[model samples]
Target: MTDTFKHRGLRQKLVETVKAKGIQSEPVLKALGKIPRHLFMDSGFLDHAYQDKAFPIAADQTISQPYTVAFQTELLEIKKGDKVLEIGTGSGYQTAVLCELGARVYSIERQQELFKKTSKFLPKLGYRAKKLIFGDGYKGLPEEAPFDSIIVTAGAPFVPKALLKQLKIGGRIVIPVGDDVQTMTLIIRKGQKEFEKHDYGEFRFVPLLEDKN
Candidate 1:
């Protein structure tokens, strides 16, 4: 709960590190700078919180690397007040970043432990998502369809069609698609049945699980 001046200085260095890695989105960098990433982790890992790397969290999931979060968020190109859906609400770090950017976020978490913990924790920090569901990320949130953008925080073997269909026309999804290693993929909906796909380079992430809750 304590974010001291030292923590803020470390976070600024982290923003610089991520920026050096080619994350140029001002909004993304600003949001990263604002969020207290160390507060999202277990106290034991506090010393490593500001490094530009992912670290283990509860349920064996990793809070995504700062650079990866920035890269994916920047690709989504979120506008203020845009409705965004986030899959795999791990430590709620990414959700906080999305909130910091002013997106109306609806996030799903398959891990009940994380879901319950984060459901309570995020609001305490004033990063309130529109909805946080303890459900399968693979299914997406169809009840709240037509999101302006969707971001999958874990690696998927392939893009989930349900997610693709959930986007508003011209909306985009930033997902990492693959197995052990993932290729960061961006798919933009062009029309009722048309999508434009682009693949960025590879990165590793926890697998996006399905139906285990």
Candidate 2:
């Protein structure tokens, strides 16, 4: 429960590192710098927490690398107060980043342990989502449909139709789609039945499991 000057300094370095890697969104970088990433992991990994790397957390899931998080977030083009659906809560690091940008996040996690852990832990760190649900992310949250943006933090074999259907027209979705390796993908909803897809390159991520509650 400690965020010190040392941590902040290390985080600044991490932000610089991500900036060198082409994550130019100032808001995203500010969020990266503000969140105490070390606090999201077990204390045992504190030394590696701000190293721009992804580390495993509870339930066999890995927190995304800082660059990846920034990349996805930058793609969403989030605006303040936008309703955003996050498809994997993992360590809640990305959730905090979204909150930092003033987005109203509705996050879902397939792993029950992670959902319980992150849902409770985020508030202690001064971050909170609009809703945190333990459910299959593939299904999205139908009742809360039409998000201004949606982000999938894990590797999906394919884009789920439900997620696309849940976006507000002109909204964007940033995701990594594939199995062993994923291509960072962005889909912008142009109209009622039109979407524009773009790929930003490759990344590796844990599989996004489906149909599990």
lDDT of each: 0.96, 0.95
Evaluate model 2: give its TM-score: 0.98
lDDT of 2 by residue, 114-141 (tens): 9899989999988979999989999999
Candidate 1 lDDT score at position 180: 98
> What's the CA error at residue 183 for candidate 2, in Å?
0.5
C-alpha lDDT of residue 203 in model 1: 98
Estimate candidate 1's alpha-carbon lDDT, on a 0 to 1 scale: 0.96
Q: Write the per-residue lDDT of candidate 1 for residues 1-213, one digit (tens) a residue.
A: 999999999999999999999999999999999999999999999999999989999999999999999999999999999999999999999999999999999999999999999999999999999999999888899999999999999999999999999999999999999999999999999999999999999999999998975
TM-score of each model, in listed order: 0.99, 0.98
RMSD of 1: 0.6
